[model samples]
Target: MSLVSPEYIRYFYYGAIVIMIPFIISDLLKKKKEDKIDGTKHFKISVYNILIAIAMMVVLFFLINSNYPS
Candidate 1:
């Protein structure tokens, strides 16, 4: 038998969701700061960065959950 708190699961799930809005907002601000960006550049850069962030998060979650490089 196992018991996990609802609060624990909520934070784990919604935390990831909550993170994405700020990421997109920051990306928008970054592009807005650039005076000479072409139309697709902002979207492209944001997509790339978001993907990288996701990859890193996945890696980190696994690493922290399990022993690695030990």
Candidate 2:
């Protein structure tokens, strides 16, 4: 091993980044009739999603690490 394996945070980072595409697409097509176009809403949603991803990372890391002890 060269150094610390980023495998620890790899899943989380990739997953969170991957979600941006769908989020952006939805935001672009979202209407203002039923729901006004609110940049704030999208921003908040993204932040919330990021936080959830981080939390999930912790859970996943532990869950996976526990199975394969090094």
- What's the lDDT for all of these models? 0.74, 0.66
- Candidate 2 Cα outliers beyond 4 Å, as residue runs: 1-39, 67-70
Per-residue C-alpha lDDT of model 1 across residues 1-70, encoded as one tens digit per residue = 1156755876777778898889878867878666355544665677688799999999999989995566
TM-score to native of every candidate shown: 0.46, 0.39
Structure candidate 1, residue pairs in collision = none
Task: Candidate 1: list runs displaced more than 4 Å.
Answer: 1-40, 68-70
lDDT, residue 39, candidate 2: 34
lDDT string, candidate 2, 1-70, tens digits: 2156666577767777798879765764563222454434654565578689889999999898795756
Task: Report the CA-based lDDT of candidate 2 relative to the real structure.
Answer: 0.66
Q: List the residue pairs that clash in candidate 2.
A: none
TM-score between candidate 2 and the true structure: 0.39
Best by the lDDT measure: 1
lDDT of 2 at 22: 94
Q: Show how many residue pairs clash in every candidate, following the order shown.
A: 0, 0
Alpha-carbon shift of residue 53 in model 1 (angstroms): 0.4
